[model samples]
Target: MKRIRASVIQPLLPDDDVAERHGWTSVEDPFDTELDHEKVFFNEYLTLAMRVDRWVVPGPLLKAHLREAEEKLLEKKSLERLGRKAKADLKVMVLKKLRRQLVPVTKSYDLVWNVNDGVAFFFSHSNKTHELVQELFERTFKLRLLVESPGTAADRRGLVAEEQRAFAALEATSLATMEVAS
Candidate 1:
C-alpha cells in the first residue's frame, strides 16, 4: 500500500548552500525554468518552491479495467481463471496503459529559509504538505529539522522555567466550543 510522505525542511546554514541536484522547475512558466545564482542566492534568505506531480488512478476505474483485461486473457487462453502471476502481470500492464492516457496531479508549495536566523517557513497549512517539503529538504541538503510549535518555540527562546511549566500544563482550547462574550 502507498503512503503519503511529507516534511518541513530547514537548512543547516553553513555560510553558502543551495539545492541544485535534480533541479526541478517551479510551478511557473515552464519555458522559463531558471534556478540562477542571482535569483536563488539571497545571502540571508532563500525563497524556494516545489512542484510535485503524481499519477492518481481511481480504484473503481482500475478494478473495471482489470476485470475487462482478465476476461480477455481468460478468453484468449481458453482458461476458467487466471493464475496469480498472470493476474499480477495483467495489473502491471493495465496500469502502464492507463498511465499513458493520464496526466499527473500537481501540487506546489513555497518555502522560505532564513539562514541568518535559525528558522525556516513552508507556507502550507497541511501537515502532509509540510512533511513533503521536509523530506525534500533533508534529501537535498542531508539535514534533519526539529518540529517547531508554540511550546517548542517558547522553549528555544528560553522562556523562564515558571512559564515553561505553565506551557506544559496548558490545555487545548477550542474557540468554537467556547462562550464568546462580545
Candidate 2:
C-alpha cells in the first residue's frame, strides 16, 4: 500500500560528509521510476534515492500459531505438561512450524533525497515505517533528518516582514458546529 508521501529537501550536511557514508552508493535499476541514481543529476545537485524492502509475516499467520499451541496443550499427555514454561515452549514450536510453512509478505518503500535542498521524501504514511527510515538514514549518513510537514514548509518559504506579522496575529478557530435541541 503506497501511502506515505513527502516532498524533497536540501542536504543538511556537505558533500564531503556524504563521502564514506557506509552504505551510500549509486541506486540500481530504479524500475520505471524517475529516480535514476546512476545517471541523472539536476542542476548540479545529487539525486539520491533507494528502495527498502521488508518481509512481514501476516498477523493471522502468527495468530494461527497461538491456536496451534493451544491445541497442542490440550492433547492427552500435553495437558499434564501445560505449565507456563511448557505452554511458552509449545508456542515457540508452533512459531517455528509456521515460519517454515508460510511465505512472508513483501513490502517496499521508495525514498528520494533532494541533496541540494536538504530534503528527503519516503512513500509511506505509517509512523513506524517513518521512524525506520529516519533511523536508517541517520545511521547510514551520520546526519540528522528534519521531516518537513506543510506548516514547516511554509515557514521555510521566507515570508515578508508584514506577512509574518499578519500570520502571527491569526488565532485558532473551531470549524465544527454542534446542533442544539429545540
Candidate 3:
C-alpha cells in the first residue's frame, strides 16, 4: 500500500523578531502596495512511501505510476492558474459592461509530493476555494480528502525547519560575511 500525507500552510503572523529576520514590516501590512491588499500565501508538501511488505514494483510500472501522478498534478495546477486569470479578466469585463465595482475573488494554492514516502499534499489559503481544491483532487485522483488543523507540535516543527532553511541559504551567500579575507 502507498501512503500519502499533505498539509496546507497558513501564513504565520509575524512577530517583531520574525519581521526583523525576514525584513518584513507589520504583519498586517499588505504584501503589495496596491489596493492595500493583505495577501496570504499557502504552501503544501507531501511525502509518499510504499509498504515494506509489498514487493517493489517493476521499473516500467513505477514509471507509469509516477507519470500518471505527474500528469494529474500538472493538469490541476494548470486549471488553477487558468481559473485565477479568468476570474481577473471577468472582473474587468464586469466592470466595463455593468459599470459596477465588483471584485472577482482569486486564490492561490500549492502542492508538493514525495514519492519516496508515498505521500501527496495540497495547500490553499482560501477557505472558500478549499472545496474546489478538494473536488479537483477527488475528480482527478479518485482520492477522498479531509482537512484537519495541524497539531501545535507539528506547527512548531515546521516553523523551525523553515527558519533553518532560510538561515542555511543566508549562510551560503557572501553577503553574510563581515570582511574580505584578502
Candidate 4:
C-alpha cells in the first residue's frame, strides 16, 4: 500500500463515450517499443500505471567525446583553421554517437481512479510524472483531466440545478486594491 502524497479529482462530463465502455482497455505507449499498453478498467478503483523508457547518455561522457573529436580535428590541421560550421558538425556527430550508446531509463507510477466520483489518485507527487499521466489518461480515454483541489473542486464539478443558477448569477469583482502606501 502506497501513501498518496497528492491527489487530483476530475469529473467526467456527461455524454462522454467512456461511460458506455466497459472493462479494461489498454492504452498504447507513445514513447517506444511494441510492449502492450497497460490496461485501464472500469471498477470501484481503476488502477493505471505507465512506464516511461528513455535513452539518456552521461553529460561527462558526451562532453569528453566532443572534446576528443575536436582535438582530432585540430591534429589534422590548425584549430583556428576549422570553420564554425565544420566544428559544429563534428560536435553534432559526436553527440549523436554518444546518444546511440545510451541505455533506457524507465520510470513507472501507479494511479488509482474512482469512476463514481471521477477522481484520480496519483501515487506520486512528481509533477513530471503527473503531466505524463494526464496526457496518457486523456489519450487513452479521450477525456480531459481537470485538476481538483478543495478550493476549486466545487466550481469545477458540474453545477446542479440551484448551484448552476447561482453560478450564472454571480458577478466577478477584483480583490486587489488600488490604494497604496505613500
Q: Which candidate comes out best when scored by TM-score? A: 1
Per-residue lDDT of model 3, residues 1-182, tens digit only: 01111222123322211211111121233222121112222233232111111112245644554455445655877643335565555433433432222222222344444435434465445665456556544653567555645443344455677776664465333565456654
Candidate no. 3 TM-score: 0.25
Candidate number with the higher TM-score (1 or 4): 1
Worst 10 residues of 2 by lDDT: 1-10
Q: Give per-residue lDDT, candidate 3, residue 17.
A: 15
State the weakest 10-residue window (summed lDDT) of model 4: 1-10
TM-scores, in order shown?
Answer: 0.68, 0.54, 0.25, 0.56
The lDDT per prediction is 0.62, 0.52, 0.37, 0.56
- Predict model 4's lDDT versus the native: 0.56
Candidate order, lDDT descending: 1, 4, 2, 3
Candidate 3: where are CA atoms >4 Å away? Answer: 1-96, 99-105, 115-118, 149-182
Over the stretch 43-126, how does candidate 4's per-residue lDDT look in tens digits?
577765565544455778878888888888888886556788997888667756665555445455666788787777876777
Best by lDDT: 1
Model 2 CA deviation exceeding 4 Å by range: 1-81, 158-170, 173-182
In candidate 1, residue 163 scores what lDDT?
87
CA-only RMSD, every prediction: 9.9, 10.7, 24.0, 12.1
Clashes in candidate 2: how many? 10
Candidate 4 residue pairs in clash (backbone atoms < 3 Å): none
Candidate 3, after superposition: displacement of residue 94 in Å?
7.7
